[model samples]
Target: MGYVKTTFLMAAMTALFMGLGYLMGGAGGAVIALVMAGAMNLFTWWNSDKMVLKMHNAQALAAGDRFGLVDMVAQLARNAQLPMPAVYIIDTPQPNAFATGRNPQNAAVAVTTGLMRSLTREELAGVVAHELAHIKNHDTAIMTVTATFAGAISMLANFALFFGGSRERLGLIGTLAMMILAPMAAALVQMAISRTREYAADKAGAQICGHPMWLASALQKIQHGAAQIDNDAAERHPATAHMFIINPLHAHSRDKLFSTHPATANRIAALQALAGTMQPNAPRMRQTDMGPSTTSVPKVRKGGKRGPWV
Candidate 1:
């Protein structure tokens, strides 16, 4: 159902873009807009992950890093039956994380230093699993496309506004309305698609981690921490705000129509409901009877040492 909704919304966004183009320059303009949107999406599909990581200055973690963060991701990846993804640590105090890649094979997971220091071992696992779920479900790719289209639509609106597009075809009043409402409509559609994927990712993350309560607990902490700490990187790149496990931007409107992620309280309630259905001792993975062994697990550093947040 989520995918279906996302598909419909994406189509609507495209139609909106083409319509704006027609309003601006007739059939020729519509064709040009469609080509530009397609080209931009293709470019974003190939390079968005790299661009996002670089924007946040994420540093890749080595497999043998003493912090054992990569090791933890390794274990979770095994449980999720996903190929090991490149892990990165962001140099920020905000407790947050996100996943990005075109597909599972090329995926990457990044967490802020604040997240590591703030969350417990179990809570961290839950967070990582949630990001991995995004990779497994290919949400990153879908979101990139959505963003690309949204951006293109906004640009088209701006172009029309500045140039007084097709003034003869669309009266001055009609052009003014397009300039004001077109970008707002694009934003609404983009936010709706983002909200839908977030719920699906939450459900799949809980299943992958085998502990709905773990994520529920993590979300609570991250939400509180994010509210207190300002992420400069997120502030500068508001468009990428939707990629995070929690909304990293501050001063968000309470209206759901404008919010990116689902409300944290509502998300926690859903997880708590999911927890009610699982057995108390149910194993995390259903594919294998045997549980993950701790023999190879590395000792995570204890004490409040402020190491890099990976």
Candidate 2:
């Protein structure tokens, strides 16, 4: 059902993009706009991971690190039946993470330093699994296409002001209205698709980790920590906020009508509901299987605060 909803929303976005183009000009103009959008999105899909990492000043986590994050991610990747994605750590105090790549094979997962300090080993696995789910689902590709469509629609809407042909088609008043409503409608659709994908990822991630409660607990802690810490990088590049597991641009406020990510509370409630259905003897990934050192002893991070994550 979730996938069905996502497909329907994606189709709606495409229709809206083409319809906006038709309004801007004619059938020929629609084709041109779609072609232009596709060309633009190709670049986005190819380099989005590198671009996002650079923006956040993310440093690659080398293998055999003392913190065991690299090894832990590798174990989780195997559990997810995915290739081990490149791992990175950002310097921010915000406990947030995001995954980027066109597909699972090319994916990279980046987490903030604060995340390492905030989550237990099990909670970290949950977060890693969530990110893996995004990679497996090709969320980066979907979001890039949707973003391109939204941008192209907005561009066409604004271009209507200068293009005399558009005025002839929609009339003066009609063109003005299109300029306003087209972008709004496109934005709404984009938000819908993003929200839907988040839900799908949450469920799939829980399954990959074999513990829905672990993710639920991680979400709460991350939500609390994120609200207290401002992600300066995310604030600067507001456009990329949707990529994170949580909305990093704002505090843990109530879910808004057009928020990029689903509300943490709602997501937790769903996970809790899922936990209710799992069998008592189901196979579960033990936290010890991740790395040599357990979450019991808080490994002091060099050049950072020396304390175990709660």
Model 1 ranges with Cα > 4 A deviation: 162-165, 251-255, 279-304, 307-310
Clashing pairs in 1: 113-309
Q: Please write out the lDDT profile of model 2 over residues 263-308, one tens digit for every residue.
A: 8999999999989997776446775766433454367777876545
Candidate 1 lDDT over 1-310, as tens digits, reads: 9999998998999999999888888898899999998899999999988999999999999887765778888888987899999999998989999999888998999999888877767777889889999999899998889888888888888788555455667777777788778889998998899889888988888887799988999998899989999999999999999899999995353537789888888888899999999766654733222223221213457774553333
Flag regions of model 2 displaced more than 4 Å. 280-283, 292-306
lDDT per model vs. reference: 0.85, 0.83
Candidate 1: 10-residue stretch with minimal lDDT: 288-297
Candidate 2 accuracy as lDDT: 0.83
lDDT of 1 at 71: 81
Model 1: lDDT equals 0.85
User: TM-score of predicted model 2?
Assistant: 0.91
